[model samples]
Target: MTRTVLVTGGSSGIGRAIAERFAADQAEVFITGRTPDTVERTAKELGVHGVACDAGDPGQVTALTARLDGLDVLVNAAGGLSQATSDDGSNLDALLAQWHAHLEQNLLTAVLTTASVQDRLTSGSSVISIGSIGAERRGGSYGAAKAALGAWNASLSAELAPKGVTCNVISAGFIDGTNFFHGQLSNERRRTLVEETHNKRSGTVDDIAQTAHFLASPGARHITGQTLHVNGGAFTTR
Candidate 1:
């Protein structure tokens, strides 16, 4: 039987890579993005369905969920940190605004999307949330939100495990390709990041995409509520 998959923020970056992976496997793939043009262009290029929806907004998420049914995989990949996304990040009020924006963009997006599509998921479905290594180190507001994501995933796993659904988070490291850094990464910083990794090389979007694919496969059914770190040993765990 053909599987049905949904990936949010799939117009570019890691999300796009994950969508392409699913499409290549001959699954019925659906991707969503905040912009119509990019979503349409990506859908046309990848031969998959695309919808214009801001996953961070509750109403848009509701609409997007309504369009999905019998979903086998839900990849929550819509999240990012913009320096100017909120009030100034220095002042107290600005700090509050920044924190709220990060939580809304990173945490709330996945929560709202999964809650809306809970019933539509099949028995063996998988929910993969994209996370960041910042959660384990000094990422500030974004890190805090990602840490909360891991916390939430643990609870979600408990609630879904009995129903045979697996939920997990992928804590990605300094992945090089794509528009993630938005062209602000300097050569010095790039070298510093590469040096921090044990592999002495930057990561690629396909690395995370491949891991997401494995988590959704039958072999990963026994794995739930786990945070799989993919940072090339930049940070080690006990």
Candidate 2:
């Protein structure tokens, strides 16, 4: 049977890859983005449904959720670094703006979107969030927000598990082919990042996409409230 999956931030990067992967499995996929052009373009390119909605906005999320019925999977993939900047490019005000943007972009987006779709989720549905390795180190404001996502996922999983719903976060590392670098990653920095990975390579969008597919699969039904690290051993606890 085909499942209906909703992937936010599906216009590009990890989210787009995830949507494409699911669509390849013949799943009925719906993706959302903050912009109309990108969302529409991605949907057309990937052959998935695309909607315009900002995950950070509660009202928009509510409307987006209302449009989705019988959701089998929900992936919170919309996230990014801060766009707000200071004139000097360094200051307390800039730092504060960055923090707020990260919080809203990462944390609030997932929270609002999940809340809006909670009731619409089927019993065996899974909710996945895209996280970052920075949550473990060098993440800064974005990391803090991602850390919160893990903590929240624990509680969310506990709450949803009894109802046969699973919630988890995928902490990704050194992902390439995305705007994540913001075009600022120097060659040396890029090399250093790849060298840090046990695989000695940067991660591809398909890596995370496949993992998301596995987590949402029936075989992964027992897995919930867990943070699955897919960093090629970049930062391992053991």
Candidate 3:
């Protein structure tokens, strides 16, 4: 049977790849983005349904999930680093803005989306949130938010597991096709990132996509409340 899959931030990058993976499997996929044109274009290109919704906004999330009949999988891929502020500004205010933006984009987006769809998630449903290696190694507000996402996933998994719903976080590292670097990744930085990986290569979108597909599959029914690191052994977890 075809499954209903919802992916936020499906307009591009890892989210787009994940949506394509599901569509290739003939799943009924629904993608959302904050922009109408981007979401519509992506949905049309991928032959999936598109909705314009900001995952950071509670009301938009509520309305978005209300349109769903039910969900087999929900992928919270709607997050990223915020734009850096000018150093010319007051350090304290700039830091505060950055922190607030990071929390809203990385943490609150997933939290609000999951909360909105919690009731719609039936037994056997899977909830996957995208995390980052930054959460483990880097020191920044964005990393902190991603860390919070993992913590929240642990609790959410415990809450949903009893009802047969599984929740997990995929902590990705140095993915190639995303706007993660925001065009600031110099050749030296790129080489450094690759050298740090055991495989000596940057991660592809397919890596995360396939992992998500597996987590939502029947084989992974027993896995819940876990953060699966997919960073080419760049960061190991005990």
* Candidate whose TM-score is highest: 3
Better of 2 and 3 by TM-score: 3
TM-score for predicted model 3 compared with the true structure: 0.97
Q: What is the lDDT ranking, best to worst?
A: 3, 1, 2
Residue-level lDDT of model 1, residues 144-229, one tens digit each, is 99999999999999999899999999999999777767788999998988899999999999999999999999999999999999
Error of 2 at 214 (Å): 0.2
- 137-221: candidate 3 lDDT, tens digit per residue: 8647888899999999999999999999999999999999989879998999999989999989999999999999999999999
Q: Which model scores highest in lDDT?
A: 3
Tens-digit lDDT track for model 2 on 184-203? 88999999999999989899
Q: Any idea what lDDT model 2 has?
A: 0.92
Candidate 2 lDDT trough over 10 residues, lowest sum: 81-90
TM-score for each of the candidates: 0.96, 0.96, 0.97
Global lDDT of each candidate: 0.92, 0.92, 0.92
Model 3 lowest lDDT segment of ten: 81-90
Model 1 TM: 0.96
